[model samples]
Target: MNRPTYNLLWRLAMPLVLARLWWRGLRESGYRKHWNERRGHYGARGAGWHTLWIHAVSVGETRAAEPLVDALMALYPNSRILMTHMTPTGRAAGHELFARHGDRFVQSYLPYDTVSKLTRFMRHFTPRICILMETEVWPNLIAVCKTRGITVALVNARLSERSLRRAGRFGRLMTQAAAQLSLVAAQTERDASRISSLGAPRVVITGNIKFDVAVPAAALARGRFLRQRINADADGDSGGAGRPVLLCASTREGEEALILDAFKAMPERPPGMLLLLVPRHPQRFDEVANLAGLRGLRVARRSTLGQDGADLDSAVEVLVGDTMGEMVAYYAACDCAFIGGSLLPLGGQNLIEACAVGKPVLIGAHTFNFAVASDEAVAAGAAVRVVDAAAMLAQARQLLLDTMTRNSMGAAAFGFAAAHRGATTRTVELLQGLIY
Candidate 1:
């Protein structure tokens, strides 16, 4: 409804939220360790004012913010950044990503969206600018920032038709939150229009920053090593001739069952073809591994393998990528990649990473979260959209068998990624303008 009602509702829900957080900590202990931060409490303030504060809700948002973060750091060399997150995974990723920066980059859990909590956070950090990654427009957070003279910008913002419809249910609350944004650097014109519909006053088409993410050299080296391990024959002879790897990256809960079933049902399956299944969440890694094993597919975990992957079983049919921050490595190691979270209408994971590594891309029909990218990628012959898991496997079969076709698609994928590489530059310019 309105701001006051929203705040009241949030206050009422805090207990339940804390309970959920504690429950999640049973699986991921990081949630249990950040109680004070979640409640807007922090230790003694020792540092100077943070130049910029960024709120990235979870892992995907945190990862997507990497290039923009780099650009911001380069532009404002003297300034420090305060990164905030809602999930432990996001915090961990932020820590890993900016660990090189040391104290210049600080992270904390974003407090609940209430005036008091946000005010405390504002007072503690005293950041001049608030940059929200993607679709994180909290009403109280925006209102509090505005009152404290903090310029709020929504960068690399996107809004799907489905999301718009959902936001419409909140009516004025969502509209007011959007209207408070100083700028919205949208990924596409459609996103800008949708955000505008939600009353964002200053929306700009700055493209998607994810396309600008540099493929890490370390990741490439790891990929090469993994490829060597994956390609080894049963006799322990590592060579160029080996199993074809089909990476199902960022797969969600229900989608894994469908994918496993489809893999099992595939007729005339290629000899020594491996399924590299990487689930989107860490909590479900064991669940996915068990699912593969229950289907009679031999599974090996990436975590169990040594640093060199020397212990990777040659006869393993499925390799569970249980590790974090190695998506690019997985992409580089795979011959073909199926970007997950789309098959069952969960709005799709990022396919851009796989494309950046010059791999043939396979996606599902429900890519509304990445609507423009998915459509343009398919149009550019860099990706193919399948309607179901069965179709996904079928296309993977064709791509795995046809070396020339796969190579052509890989080339196109790399070209597509290269052509959209300046979003970070544009976004940084906009942020500079906002700050000045």
Candidate 2:
């Protein structure tokens, strides 16, 4: 399909899309709050021109864009950035991330990918450059930007074999979109090759920007305090004196049930071990908590705990991390971390954060989303890949009991994270060439 066909299909589906957004708003009100922006009607709020515009669709993309955003801000001191998102969660994450910058960093919901809406967005923002984080290559969006003389870059880009196959189904629509990109700073050579196959004319290997993201000092301190609270001993002297914590971070929909069942079925669990379950989506926090309770496991929510987790019950078997923007803290607090979304075929969530926090990492078989990182991390002795939830827990049990191996893996994980730094700097340099 070509641009015209894609646009016609998009226009036809706009009503269904709006209805879905409205339905999602019932669970997450942020979706409903920015209705006008969805229609490309920013009005007076979007009056000024931006130097750079970034489209980071959701939370993962938003978070991945953080270091690159900072680098861009530093490189262009007086420039304004227009951040766009497709999800309320991404918008919220961006707002929290760049809140200190005030008006210099503006955010809006990306307009629908039709010619008119895309044209309106481009006219309103008047951004000289558009940087799309990860795999966001909308046909109409790219076509409109190119026509309007906007330099579009797909930075920190990645493409898995599975994604390539899916994109192949769209044929010319995907190829034309990729061909329109001025640059694609891919995370790996494999990604560059895959993107090249999709017809991106200018692809470069700039590594993964996520490795360059700095762990906030405050997050580490918070992690220490949380660890103390989570591991409070029998006598209440909370100085790393309690049970070992196994953090199941960024777990997806079906993986939680598998993990919970595995945890319950473990015949030889580590003595006084606590499971810290953090779901990937905020809307499913209550659902996850209920899942734990239904399994007869004593569950406690992070949201209900006091400022320092003072009200945390000592007898709790599972701790549900229901908060947002605290992934670093969660990683730092855990003894070992299991990266989720991989147990099934859902592609894995980011395991780099856990490694950055110097924790032993556990991943599942499916990690195509982060294929290079996962394989390299496992090869570096920083991470171990298990086949399923049972294997994950079994491995976790062994790691929890073996302190020496765990500590060694933790050190390797930190080293692995440090070794892959400077992607942001490289990407910024390339972007500078485009701007000039």
Candidate 3:
């Protein structure tokens, strides 16, 4: 727990640390206005109330917190919910929390997990409890929160082999931080064991909160509007058969290259085969467009597809979903999905979006982060996992070539997503014990 050693150790981890800093730099530049507005909440502002500060780091975490946040408001009607996120994408998505739940909650960019920023943020919120979503654990954040007599819990907690091994190297440092957690409500039993090994408090199996999300009725109607906007036929075909669209969601950088290669080599690229590539981050929309263009395929822009959601484009391949908050529409419109980030070392993208709609989902072997949910889907025949791009291409080709197979896989996936539902209730029960 020595500061000097920890700083030196983190310095050795410069590559990852710098990568994060570089990412924040891009956010600052690309989303200046958005960042400025949200960044204002970094200091102590909502003090002197019963506050439960929740950290949903990015889009996935933010989306996953919908049900839990709802429960928090239910248990403590007067208690203010302050949600913090570090990324612009996260901040934007977190705003949805406010939109859906009302003034009981507010979203802000989390202060840096350093002591000064941590102190400032803590003093501002003066939270009675801190519930960290998923696997995020910042040392100074935990230490400061613990010192403030805040009851801290890690909700929907997961621990992969990679994270476990990495945290293992910093045994005392991680243990001291993790030990501060008052309760550890994990997503999987495996996650509990991993955290326990790292000296986390006895972790309770609370299940995954992503399953608890309330898929908006507005989103469903909007998805149809988006499909019509893109001119996707009622039958789920792109105007003139190119190859049935593979609407990819949440794809990151390096994975695009692999996906492109697989798409390029398809022996009989289906009629109306459009790859609507939506990068995970808005800042990387341009970056991903460049990568997809380098593949020498005709590309389309979603913004240009239709003027209004009610209009129709009906003819555009490779529509880049570079806009903010339109995932539900694209996921509904696509015939199936290739959920990226899994093909490379990025640890997979969300399959729930596709699964919700019963679209056949394909992910690669790099799904360490969501291994619990991913495995459940695969076991139930709701999702398919390939070892690499080669296998991924083969699976995609097979699924695209055969409608029955695709339909069956999608059916299984819908079943899987449905059965694994209700984490929000369990999570709410846990928080009610404290916040209520």
After superposition on all C-alphas, the RMSD of every candidate to the true structure, in Å, is: 2.3, 2.2, 3.4
Off by over 4 Å in 1: 232-240, 307-311
Alpha carbon lDDT at 417, candidate 1 = 95
Sliding window of 10 residues with minimal summed lDDT for model 2 = 232-241
Off by over 4 Å in 2: 45-47, 232-240, 307-311
| Pairs with backbone N, CA or C atoms under 3 Å apart (clashes), candidate 1 | none
Q: In angstroms, how far off is 350's CA in candidate 2?
A: 0.7
Question: Which clashing pairs does model 2 show?
Answer: none
Give the alpha-carbon lDDT of every model.
0.89, 0.89, 0.76
Measured with C-alpha atoms, the lDDT of residue 316 in candidate 2 is: 91
Per-residue lDDT tens digits for candidate 3, residues 1-436, read: 5656765665576567546666777555634433432323443356767778899888888888888877778778788788888776788787855666676677667765556557767777778888899888988778887787787889999989899999878768788988888888898898989999888865789888787666677877766666666555555544334236677788887877777777777776666566778888787787777776887766667766656435434344467888877787777777778787887787887788778877888888888888888888888998888887767767766777787888788788778888888878887777777663
Pick the winner on TM-score between candidates 2 and 3.
Answer: 2
TM-score of each: 0.97, 0.96, 0.89
lDDT of 1 by residue, 103-159 (tens): 789999999888999888888888999999999999999999989899999999999
Model 1 superposed RMSD (Cα): 2.3
TM-score of predicted model 3? Answer: 0.89
